[model samples]
Target: MSGSTAGPEALEPLVRAVLAALADGAARRGGPVPAGPPDALAEHVAGEYAAARGEGALSRLTSLLAYGSADPADPLCAAHLHCPPLAVAVAADLAVSALNPSQDSWDQAPAATTLETLLLGEMAELVGYDERAAGVLTSGGTESNLMGLMLARDRVVGRASGRQVELAGVPRRGPRLRVFTSAAAHFSVQRAAALLGLGEDAVVPVAVDRDLRMDPDALAEALDRCADDGGLPVAVVATAGTTDTGVIDPLRACAELAAEHGAWLHVDAAYGGGALLSDRLAPLLDGLALADSVSLDWHKLGWQPVAAGVFLVRRAETYASLARRAVYLNPPDDEEAGYPSLLGLSLRTTRRADAFSIAVTLRTLGREGLGRLVDACHDLARAGAEAVRSHPRLELCSEPELTAFLFRYLPARGPYDPVRTDRINAALRRGLLREGRAVVGRTELPGTGPGRVRLKLTLLNPHATPADVERLLHAVAEAGRAEEAAEEAAGRHTGETGEETP
Candidate 1:
């Protein structure tokens, strides 16, 4: 393992150059994102990664994504909640990367292990849990949720004739275990079921009300039917804030249902966890305390870098399934010596110090500071929804529950045609993306009809105001008109020229 010819000393200049290039590109991104034509976009990306082993190529490579990618930091980039992170988070990330510490064990990462544990405790408190609550840093909502369901599966199987699933496989003699969740719930739950050997079919899609909240009565009836059919109830997954609509399920009612059915309760609050900071928004998480486990992703709402996810459980003892001991790792004598450890907490053996950034962000923003950001985004969503409803061309899809909107543009043309409308809306979104004018998102609106396209605006930029959102909608409308005009021109060309309008 000989050192490179450049040596470590050469990195200082390279790093500085990289940062300067990134900063320059970021500063220049003051306008809408560029949605370029096919050839241009392809060239930009090709030039970015084209040449290899060339001097100063890294600088050009940095500029490729730095300038070409849609800027989530820009208030106009209303696409997703993986928004611009706090500067402190970036700095902390740099420190962690430099230190290269792993929080898996006390000897491996003493400070990181301590910091992660304390931060997990603070996060548990935010979830309205007592001192008994235990948590571990995860990759994101998906891993957090996978472990939660894994725990539920083990417990359910254990209760089923005292089977230990870790040693013995999932019981084959009993009725298959079923997980209940709203249709609007995150897909991670189903994915978790598959990983845990429950099969995707193990999940039961409970209907949601008009507000997209899980219907408690429907869940109750489903649970009753499951019992009658001799189906073993495993867990009830409740969504605190769904990804697409940001809808919150009725947590209290879901908790009650879980209690009555003797099932584990897990709340997927990866997107909505930031509401716990705001007194106003926190109420939406009522009955969260009743959940057996909860997932939170600071990267989504806490203004932190990626991979800042936490999984909290009400009882610390429930994590016994993750416990493992080895002489080289957690030796028997070392455990008795009171050396604090976090090795048995997560699914990873060499976990990064993600909690370092999370701790710094929480301390930097405090609860109120974080809450204000959440409040600002929610206000912007309401304002944007109002703007949509008032606009002649735009129609609000559903009343916003969080900082998100699901709406589509209404063309000023002949009779309403779902197919034509969906096409125009989708084309308009792609046009906007290609031009980099606006980074608006698009999703199917099954509520309206199958294959229907609906424009989405996830207002993650806290500094953005209602006026900014109005301007965004105006931009979207203009793009829609241009897309419609292009479509009409193409149709007319096809009628006259009779050649395929490329």
Candidate 2:
């Protein structure tokens, strides 16, 4: 029996059941993440699938699987960039999938292609790019960075040489291609270099300032030395929001230096690109438009669903370097028909309609609302930092440059033991995860001596209050004390006295 043979009346109950489940899940928001695996639920679904198959109801299996994933509503789910997407975005995502719009070709997805271009225009305008700018919707910041690097490589080596090298598998004609970025820059830059056949060694890590921002002087020195050493300075990557510290590098200075050295400038603003929405912090990214390319993730700060990232270039013709015509895919005839395929400009083909969700999100939450969200997150971060500073056991590393803070638990009196400190901090983090209290991140900073590892909190959740952050900190301190007590008791039993455990 075909699924089309089923009457609408038969599907009404299943639809209602799915909607009810979604509503129940939505109602359980603002709590700690579920601690246990959802395997039991999955097993139940597997049994149901088997039974449904027996009953010839296999058509419903896809819907069942789509609706049955583990709920992220639980509050303890603050581990990564994953968040419960906005309601508007969720609805738009469903519509996008149902339409199955592919932005690769206009014949397949006419509206989707135009929508993506419009959304790209909006994003470029947000980053101060003019109408002459062109961009493509990417999977995420990583893909965007790779696309920008590929363009940089092609531009630096000349278009014809780049094509010959790619097609004929010949060596690049340019000097040893090199890229520069702060040590704190995201790992994607190095990954991009490697993917472009430049190897990891091609990415030179510039020193960062005390606040974790890229040091302009260090960048200049690195570029000059690279040039003098017969290395082709391909591009300089300036990070807007670093992964750990959320630090925005000196963009204006970096842009000026890139221009002076005739190097391509790519700003990885995947995390901090939303700062452009803010009146206060927008100046921090003042020179973003001056870059040859910029990467922005609407999924990060725009509160859109995942896979919402854009790669914008200042010169529209820069993308011509990536343009290639395939007879079966995008024939020359299609080019004259106003049928522009995003495939030529991006690393992806048959891409999703991620831009629709972003468009819906931006339309629902206007520029003012977006700016307010950014400002609110920054304010909440500051409040959290103040809470950490006021706490007796915690120490704020420095004032937050953006909506992130790095701090560690400080011993109240005794001299700091790096080994003991690491154990206590690790224990505190484990306890928090085990107890399902909070999800604070951990990072290691290489110091002059043995280096020190500390806890980091990324304050992207605008709804998170200072009280919530304080509660998490207090939990960390309590966990630290409990671990110390356990260690002391073990030491007493072992007759080790005050000696630190390895």
Candidate 3:
């Protein structure tokens, strides 16, 4: 076992082998990803699995997995909200993994439970919540959003009907319960509603402005319309950072509306919560403190590994709906005897000690150090946006609010043909993936239009230079040109032979 006295001695050799395999795999790939089609990687994986011979299996498979992965650390791999984890954080994670503590019971993870409690308290203060606030670490934004909506449903909906939602279910004959979020808000809100037995149709999509942020006026109108239709507003979910353009909805305005309507305000700040670290950007989240609950994803912007998500609430008492009394986990006698338990705080039973790594990371790199990293990435995004604006082939969809921007490539020789442009942009992204030249992101704008397709640059790597951004853009333009040329050639051949060629 890793917790045994001889754990370090046993791990040393295995870790060394794994490290060697990683280096070898990265060296062989030599780019963000392996240059080939999806099937090629699949076949390689199959071959490796079939050829695994007893002792060396770990090394062989580790190397194969590393080679196939799209390395987020690579400057060119600016695809999703995925960040390259800091070495310090990863090292801390190793310690947590070795011990393998579960936080469901106090006895199972004594120190871990304490650390998680303290971490959540600090995070609550950072979010402007008072000492009565409480939170729990989550897998990511999806679970966080679900928890927030779930509390909102039980607290608000239950209060209105004067019934306990946990013991009793949602009433069928009550006023229609509704949730309001921006058109650009994360899809998790609707999914959460569905999971809570409120059908997907219960969500009212508030219109967004040109910048893809929720219009406060539109939100007000929607709320009024819901009231007019005798529908109860359960919650208002405001997105702090939209995935496509990174635009934040007007928080203060949304908060005001939610309060006036007696609706619970849940801010999905999974992408923008990192702004709290930076003095320059923290002001953008001015009214975040007013939220009833908030979701933050450290994996996206806190430079932690995957699944480092946090969910917080304004008051601990609001979490009553999730309280539990498992005799083995958190018995009344244990609580009376002053032994703490975290079984009631999570949607999970056997939860890992994820807070340990976050605590280590916070201590190692103080607030100032993490803030600087946030500023660096923000600076990089601004610089990259300027580059996109200056380029003839690139068209900036909007200036970045956080660390991501949206832009599309324009063909060098074509008259403005929206359909053809969309096709070329889509094809170019796939072309880059096949060639392993770059790993850029792709997304469509809010509307269903011919020109909605856009390439994205989510610059999460703070160390990546302006030159790297310029080079990635150039690679995208080159790929776009190749795709355009192929399309034109195909059209010419079809015109000559009167038959479409493959």
Candidate 4:
């Protein structure tokens, strides 16, 4: 109905209602998220849905969604890699949704096919790829990673066994294929390996340095071991921004080592690719141009809506592994007639026109505008790290590399107890969530131990100020104090209950 000629007129009133409902919902359950236990929030949402049995279902459901969302735009909601999208991008996405053009075939999405092709070219250039590069828009980093590794598998394993992997499947007696990546790399690598018929154990985790970046020497040793054991080194995945600390592995070293071992180099820049826009931070990813494939997510730092992920390869020829044909979609005659189709480039059969939003954002802001926003967030993170260091109860764990830092709250009065400290840090984050005061991230430093737990703050909102970050930290400390008091009170209660019947 939204695609009809009268749709615009019909949508005007509905759009206004949705806007009003959004405001009302945000005002009703304020802070970062709805304040209550998880079950209570769920029940309230169920009740709203059940009550909306008539004409106003849209208004009620939209209101409930906005109310329940963990608002990334809120300064206190520095929890994850989620970003607040720009208004221009959101508006562009609305146009795409109304039209509903599927990108799988040429006739289905003529203009969109061209737009996505051009956008991928520009993104490939951003990753230092030449004109021969080819890529496709994806759901996010996870899918992009899968595409990259799938290509690596078919190319490497197929060559070693001299057979088409797509037809015969991985040869049981062929050389073993191994993927080398830093221990800090995203878990998607193992998942991709498993999905490709290479068991999860095929992934070898190389050691990382003190800063949590992959050590190049360790990678070389792993590659050597794999080759010595009659295994083929299929790919080396390097992290441009690790999830917890935002540390980039030594890219130049990893690329060189991968090349020496005849392995594909794939850089997972899902979190740090936004730095490419900033002149100040671009130098950090010096060897990224050497990678055979790269994965980027605009939803993280590019300020676009979700599903704005891209996967690019250095040469178009390498994408042959993903090529496909369907008579109903893109016949040989259609291609010869110059009616290009995007069916061959993607693993998906039906895809949204997600590129439109990213293209609009790029034209609206340009490089310098977005770069300034990136710099602003980075500055806010530096200010936050300083605040954490100066606070008496907060202990700074890692320095900010992009726009995130890790730190944890220490007990104000007691001597350090790793077990108790971990518990306090864990409880404080939930305590803030329960009160609807703040939304902070919690993670553990890599290793096995009680003291590994740490709180994280991923600063993505450029409009957020240093004072806002300071207030967030203060709230965390206060919550930590409250948790400590509760622990002591519970301990006293247990001791009193266990007392002999005097």
Candidate 2: global Cα-lDDT? 0.77
Tens digit per residue, CA lDDT, model 4, 269-344: 9999998989999888999999999999999989999989999999999999789999999999999999999898
Candidate 3 lDDT (Cα, whole model)?
0.91
Enumerate residue pairs that collide in model 3. Answer: none
Sorted by TM-score (best first), the order is 3, 4, 1, 2
Q: Per-residue lDDT for 153-215 in model 1, tens only? A: 888778875978877878878786999999888889999999888999999999888777899
Q: What would the per-residue lDDT of candidate 3 be over residues 1-502, giving only the tens digit for each residue?
A: 6778899888888889999999988988899989999998899899999998897998998999889899889999999998999998888888888989999999999899999999999899988998999999999999999999999999989999999987798989979999999988889999999999888999999999989989999999999999999999999999998877778889999999999999999999999999998999999998999999999999888999877999999999999999998998999999889889888889999998888778888999888899999999999999999999999999998899999999999987646777767778999999999998899999888777577888999989989999999999999999998987887777632323233356
Candidate 1, superposed: residue stretches over 4 Å from native: 1-15, 27-32, 37-43, 52-55, 446-451, 492-502
Model 2 per-residue lDDT tens digits across residues 63-166: 45544543333333344555557778987886786567777777778898888888888888999989999998888889989988888877765542545444
Judged by TM-score relative to the true structure, which candidate is superior, 1 or 2? 1
- Model 2 residue runs over 4 Å out of place are 1-16, 22-31, 36-79, 159-165, 168-174, 412-414, 446-449, 492-502
For each candidate, what TM-score against the reference? 0.93, 0.87, 0.97, 0.97
